[model samples]
Target chain A: MKLQKPNDVMLQVSMRVITLFIFAFSFYLFLAGHNNPGGGFIGGLMTASAILVLYLAFDMKTITKAIPFSFTTMIGVGLLIAVATGIMSMLFGYPFLTHFFDYFLFPLFGEVELTTALFFDLGVYLVVVGAAMTIILAIAEDDK
Target chain B: MSNLVILPIIIPFIIGAVLIIFAKHHRLQRVISGFTAVGMLILTIYLAFLVYQDGNIVLEASNWPAPFGIVLVADMLATLMLLLTSIISTACLFFAFQTVSSDREKFYFYPFFFFLIVGVNGAFLTGDIFNLFVFFEVMLLSSYALIVHGGTKYQLRESFKYVIINVFASALFVVAVAWLYSVTGTLNMAHISQRVAELEQTGVINVIAILFFIVFASKGALFPLYFWLPRSYYGPPAAIAALFGGLLTKVGIYAIIRVFTLIFYHEPTFTHKGIIVTIAGFTMVLGVLGAVSQFDFKRILSYHIISQVGYMVMGLGIFTPLAVAGAVYYIVHHMIVKTALFLFAGATERITGTTDLRKMGGLIKTHPVLAWLFFISAISLAGIPPFSGFFSKFPIILAGFQEGQHVISGIALLVGLLTLFSMMKIFSYAFWGKQKHTSEQAKTPIGKLLLPIVPLVALTIILGIAAEPIFQYSLLVSEQIMDPSIYIESVLKE
Candidate 1:
């Protein structure tokens, strides 16, 4: 079934602004996961919900044209990133999932703490978004 | 090195994730999955050899010391299980290549297959209890997809029940783990064992023991909880069925053995002898009865899984060194032979386009190779001499009598006879009757299919022929596991 729909001016206009904040908040949550309660899982869900709002305000065809990525490939990339973070340790003769961290000075900012776990969390965030959207779209689908 | 212990889980985990990106490229998926399976088989064999040489290989995940972080421990028993998982999964993976439909393959069958392996290997190798639960979920989630891959009306219907039952079990698992944590204050299995030793198998511990048993028994297809095995296993395509039959329930059995031996050892008469013995007797009798009552080829084999599981747990129930060794031996034998039988069922189903015993016959005249290979598997399953099953079962029954548990041992022996009867029933109905299929159907080529299964059949025979050394190896393993202190020390010693 084609996902054609008439535009709703208010949903479209309101979501265009609201979705950006949601995306920003999700990014904050995803980054904050390392030391705080907010981490990749919830972050990914936040991002997904933001995208979901976009899909809700726009037609699926339009949404597809705007955000063009297969949900499965997103999940795959996410898993690969998360697992690779752990696997990188083994290459250095450390046990699996042995994370590493260091404080590096930035040009724009003071010293910033960098860690492999952040990448791992990023992977989790992506997977959560991919999985949630995939489930929703699968259910929301019109009969073929 | 400790790093090697982590490879089995990582290999599958990485390959599974990679396969997802190429889901639509079925040929690439097959090539990559095929190579990964063979690579895993080699890696596990080498890992097992390392463990044999030096003892337990422990990888403290994230370099955290035991009691604080996740750990993967490859002891003799775990390494043996990894070896078996690699063998059966390698066979099933190849068999699946030929048998599973392209539509199903397109739906990410190969990725889920490796993820299932990730879960299985992780479950066997993890030294942390919570991680065990995590691995169980990974395995079950993939299975839920694989089971319902075809999306046939029957598959969807049956898998709903399967998913529900397992979800409920996983919930109870967390509950059991929580209660365990509350009592022991630890999530690391070795630490839990250390803590449980101090707590003793008293009132709450015994309750938790039984609760843990229930969680695992549901997964393992034991006794009263086995109602879902036959129907749900019947719904999937045969290769998935073969994989599930060969590896999944064995994980449950492995957990039972691990938990009972390590953490719940106090008051053996209560937990091991009294409760486990009675359950084993019932599981064996009722399971074979279910098999004997079934006429469909796959259903019979599915029900047989329950009965054979009873034998594995029976060894644990007996709780002697010999008995536990027999249990270990039984597990290895069953994983190989069961896969062979299921693949045979799959092979025959492909030719006749049906699994009902009454609907298939005279394959022996047309497919002699399939006929005899299946016969070896069937008899090995029945405990016939000079086969792996006989050697494996002999020690368990012998130990049972020596322990003077005559009634349960008698039940075990009687179940073996009934198992033979059911297998022969399958044989006579499916292979020996007048020709049932048309000439073209009868002549359908199964050589490629049979090629993948050959290794499984050969392993069962090799396991039998090499029973002397293999049984000795299992005895060593049983010795290693029967005393929990060895594990606790290996994990806790910095």
Candidate 2:
């Protein structure tokens, strides 16, 4: 299961444009996650897809070596973060999975404020990326 | 309160993480897993009794406010499922102790098993739909590994299909969650119910409900989506088979019950009361036919898992408290007896080296203990008189009649009789006829190998003898589920 060769020039150019658009959209989604529609899940998927396209186009062996950490551990860490965000409520005298309060502020860039839900969404983003990558890569390795 | 919500998942998860480092040492891994399983059982039972006294325990993770943060709520339904999972996990682990080879056990099986329990428990307890999807992936990924643990040609081939289908289902799950969030603007289950109630029953919600149903239907192995269970289950050893048989489908059932009764109750005319009954009846009839067609001992049991799920779902479709309570009670009884029955198949297979009923005979004379235990569970599975299965079904059928669903009632009755016939076929072919095996092999007897099934066998009888209190408890669970305002208020209350 060697990685498929990189897509030719036309395909690569189209993929690059798509990747850039996704990155910008994903950032917007993550920034507007709280009180608005988008969040970390969409953002994470966008980022992961961008990475995945590159990996699939370039060699997987190169992609595998380029990564700095294990996808499975990233999943574990993501889940732990998600779970930990929920656990933080208990420390402040709430029940399991109770979220702390939040505040909203509109800034020059956009509305910006800290919310535990943002943390939860981030955790979700990580899990989605970790799980997708793990399954895809594991299947690829198995084929090999 | 936290103990009630998080302990069940946390202990198994911590132990599972630790086992990864010790995966090479079979003996050490077994000892740790054994201790963890026993701990989980004790914790689950104590928690069940706690819920019995104090009502449901809703733990908001990290003490966040409700409707804003995720919650892990333990109502009677969650605790009951947890108790059954712990029981099945313990029994299956013991059976695995005797049967699974050291080489296979050493390959991170114990850790993966623990992780699987974490996913199962999380799925039952989660208060958010998206979080449920996360837990589900956690569970299924581990299952993918465990199912093909040894990487046999058959295991790999079948599990690949299983993995691909579930992956696709999970993608649909995300899609559904995204759509739901767009419509309701909330992911908290209780909050979704509250919001959906204020809005009109739009066509969009109906489409979303069907989408959610499709995802769970595939998971639960409902009428049109059940082809994956039988073949994929055949890949694992008996112990894992028993675990999957007992708990996995129930998770799907739990999700169905939770969503339909809580969030989707806003439009029962289109969603809950109508679709559930229609699909459930078909699920029961078709599943039994599949069972009747199969000759393999394990295959028959696997098919019956689908059929029995129908009865539980039928109770839900009835929409009356009596019927729903019956479904809850039926779930408890079925999970226990079904796991025991599968373990018995595993033992018989261990002794005879074949699951094909045509390949062996007359086990009652040589291994009377195994035969009798199998007999009790089989009879219970068939819903015979004096067994918990019958008691559970009686209320369901009575509730069905009371609700004027005579056709469904009639189908359920016919399914019950066919279930009895399928179980009897196994009893006669594998236990009652002439001894076809060599004398030396017969002397080894399946009796010693069958000891792990003793506790579950005893549990079936106990459930039968103490049917009154348990049935009353089921009534309470159904009442709680039906009037979920209490659940929502507690979770969302400031």
Candidate 3:
């Protein structure tokens, strides 16, 4: 089950670059999710893949040094954030997970609309990323 | 007030997340989880009281209208089940505190336990079918983790089967939900019921109903589908096995009762009488036979869970108010007693260091207290007089006779007799005869373990002595369920 490393240096460099691009695109998907197609689940998977690419390009030891925090903590935080948004709505005398949206006008930007659901989606994104990484890392480590 | 309905589901979810962070601090994790379980129990009891007084309480999630958004409903049955779930889970948690290894504790057992609760409560409370599927996944995912927590070879092998079977059932559940949605165009239960009533018993509707039954019955471990239960359950620690024995299949039973009564009642003769009654009869007969053949402590009890579930479904099959009431009563009684019995098994295992009845003996001489406690629960499980099991079973059998289902009632009585024989087999072999392993056995103090079992044993007795009020409550619950109009109007407001 040893991971086969590519001999070519160009492959590793290109993988790193592609990983960054996917990470940024996932963020874009997550932010535009409330009004558009992409949301937390897909965005989170994209981010996890970026990390996965890093794991693929680098050795397990180097990747562990790069990401020091426990992946499970990300899951816990993501779940807390998602549940907190629901509880926040409950605190405002609304049902759980009831989203509220409002638009504000700014001098620099024309207008921006914010929704509580976006934060909920962010929480979902983090959980997906964390859960995916946990499984992948565990499997990869087990192979070693 | 309606918001209270969602608290049972949410409180656990929040606690589970928090416990994940404190996973390394075992003592702190125990304290936090203990307080949360107690708090949730109190909250569930209060909610049950409110529902008992004020009829059904429905909370539309995110302020979505009834049919348009997800809702959590706490009617008599749901709240009743919620109360029972909280009681058993709390007991199991405390029992785990005494018995679960520190290694498992550090591996996030408490978090997964709470998550399992979140899933169970969510399954009982959700008003939408799709939400039920989601909650089932949550429960199954945590169960998959918990069942294999120790990662023993036996645990790994058995849990793999358990996971595969449940995953298949879950997929079938989603397919059933999708088919029903395609047919009825609504996911909300009450709305679907209304549509089902309007559509009458079309062949497509009946097919969908049968599909749903197969999905839940597999989860509930009915007859042929119960192959995964005994071996899989035998692999986990007794505390986990107890929790699964007590609550997991009952969730499936709860779903069956909810859907059959609310949405698929139009053709009782075929679905309830023909199909369910037949399954109930076989489930009882085969389950008891399996139990009678088992030579291990937990394996026998695991088989008995399937057997006892047959009685509950038989009550539903009888399809009378008294019968359904009896089924409800049986659920409450069975959950408490079965969990207590398993906890007792765990305590005995701790002392003797084995689950094999052949290798274990003289527990009655060594630990008279544990022996007596097991005796009481065993007899109660066997439907002996002056215990909760007898009273709960009495109504179902009586109702079966009254309804002229003589053969099914006769089968129920016969199964009860076999159940007694098997329990006594366990008693004599494990507790009574010569001290088979007395020289090798350690006299581990079980005071902490006994703490959880005592309340459950007491509750079983109280449920028996105070059967009048409990019976009346079950009747009220049955009436509300038997007549779906109340549930529909309360939820949909049309």
Q: Which one is best on DockQ?
A: 1
Q: Is candidate 1 or candidate 3 better by DockQ?
A: 1
Chain B alone vs. reference chain B, TM-score for every model: 0.99, 0.98, 0.99
Q: Write the per-residue lDDT of candidate 3 for residues B382-464, one digit (tens) a residue.
A: 99989999999999999999999999999999999999999999999989989876554646687788999999999999999
CA deviation > 4 Å runs, candidate 2: A1-144, B1-3, B445-448
lDDT of 2 by residue, B260-355 (tens): 888887777667568888899999999999999999999999999999999998998888899999999999999999999889888888778899
Tens-place lDDT per residue, model 1, A1-144, is 767656689989999999999999999898888888899999999999999999889868899999878998999999999998988888898888889889999999899888889999988988899899999999877544
Models 1 onward score TM values of 0.98, 0.82, 0.98
User: With candidate 2 superimposed using the best TM-score fit, by how many Å does residue B289's alpha carbon deviate from the native?
Assistant: 0.8
Higher DockQ: candidate 2 or 3?
A: 3
The CAPRI classification for model 2 reads as: acceptable
User: What Cα-based lDDT does every candidate model obtain?
Assistant: 0.93, 0.86, 0.93
- The clash count of every prediction, one per candidate, is 0, 18, 0
TM-score, structure 3 vs. true: 0.98
Q: In candidate 1 chain B, what residue range of length 10 has the lowest lDDT sum?
A: B1-10
Task: Please give, for residues A21-123, the per-residue lDDT of candidate 2 as tens digits.
Answer: 8778887888788778888887788878877887766667767887877776666567667777756775665565566555566677464467787777887
